[model samples]
Each structure stands twice: as C-alpha cells, then as structure tokens.
Target: MKTWILPALGTLVCWGFWAFIPKLTTRYISPMSAMVYESMGAMVIGAIVLAVLHFRPDVSGKGIFLALATGMLGMAGGLCFLFAVRSGKVSVVAMFTSLSPLITIALGYLLLNETITLKEGLGILTAFIAIYLFSAS
Candidate 1:
C-alpha cells in the first residue's frame, strides 16, 4: 500500500518478463534488427501516451535533455543485451547486468551527495561478491 511498492513490484514483474523475451527474440534476428523493432514498439507506446496528454507535454529543457539521455541509454543497453544474450547464457548475463545499479549508487553519492547507509553499502558489497562468484563458475 506504500506509494512506491506498486511501481516497484510492477517493475520486478515487467523486467522479469522483459529479460526472457529478448533472449527468445534474438534467436531469430540480429541485435540491430531487434533494436529497430523494439524502438518502433516504444514509439507506438509513446504516441498513445502523447494522445492521452492531448499532444502537449511539459516540454521543459531539463526534462527533454534527461528524457533524451534515458532513451539513448535504454537503446544502447538494449542493443548490448540483444547481442550478449545471443552468445552468452541469458541467466548469467541478466545476473551480471542487473548489478548496473551499483554505478547509479556511486554516481548518486558522488554527484548528488546521496549518502549510503551501512546496510545499503553491505548490500552493494554482497552484490559484487555474488557477481564475482556467479561469473567464476
């Protein structure tokens, strides 16, 4: 019932499914082709959202820049994931890739001065250890 819980849970399930679908898709097409189709799907979803907003978004300079950056990162990550899943174990790749938040945490701490508690630091340490152990197999 918390404000973030629903979206957090939704993300978990959506990404859980998203992780599986790309592996299946990369089987039939190259990463570039898969990315093209994926972008098209995203564009269609964006169009619907724009229609719902009556085609007038906030259009702020900062918001636009961040949105563009997010799209660029998402596209690049998707392309990499597609190429990786084709040649590597999907589970292992997913495990390793999911640790990307460690970068976010470090950036947040350095750039935004977001303090990391001892608990979160331990979690991050554990994640890196797990990644090392998991990949060493």
Candidate 2:
C-alpha cells in the first residue's frame, strides 16, 4: 500500500492539472498547437531532469517511437477534449470524460492481464454511477 500511495497521489495531481490544461490552452492557441507546445514542453522538462540527475535518457529506436506515439495520442486526446469543452457544456464534457478511467481499467484487463478485485470492481461501478449522475443534463 505504501508503494502505491505516492504514485497514486502523483498521478492524481498530474491528472488534476492536465484536465484543466485544455481549457486554459483554448484561450490562447489552437488546440493542435497547444498540444504540440505541451508535448514539447514535457520533452524539454524531462530532458532537463534527466541531465540534472546525470541519467542518460533512453534514445533507443523502440523507446523513441513509443514516446512519440504516446505524445501524438495525448495531443489528439487533448484536442478532442478542447473541442468537447468548447462546443458543449463544460460540466457535461467533464463528467463524460471522467469515465475515461473505465476505459483504462478495461484496457488493463484486456492487454495487461490485470485482475479487478471485488473492491476495485465496486469502485469502478461507483465511478460509473457518479459519471452518469454528473453527465445527466
């Protein structure tokens, strides 16, 4: 539990800020441009941190390809989110997107062979309920 707690907290913090980033970016730049800038910023920061730590960054072909692919997917997701927030009600878009964890969980199960215990299954169900309630317009 101790091992998981900090990572979970960090992820929550990252996601909390990430969720608002699209809304903020839409104010200044086009969604695609905003995403590009965000990805570039992330890369720069990551490189700086590695340099500071005297750690060599992974530059293998597979790693580079995977990172680039992930960045593209993230940018696409951000663009879609920006469009959703701009064209529809923010609350509705947010509430619907909040259900994204369900997709992650499903993918984990399918691709990673991760098992969902009873408690986790219940939590997922609760999350779905909350999403449904919040998304109801």
Candidate number achieving the greatest TM-score relative to the actual structure:
1
Model 1 superposed RMSD (Cα): 1.0
Give lDDT: candidate 2, residue 91.
65
> Candidate 1 lDDT, tens digit per residue, 1-137?
78999999999998888777889998898889999999999999899999999999898999999999999998999899889988998889999999989999999999999999999999999999999998888
Residue-level lDDT of model 2, residues 1-137, one tens digit each, is 68999999998888777776677667787776776788788889788998897897657999899988987787778779887866676667777887887898999999999999999999998988887787775
List pairs with backbone clashes in candidate 2. none
Q: Give all candidates' CA lDDT scores.
A: 0.92, 0.80
Candidate 1 deviant stretches above 4 angstroms: none
The parts of candidate 2 lying over 4 Å away from their true place are: 53-55, 59-64
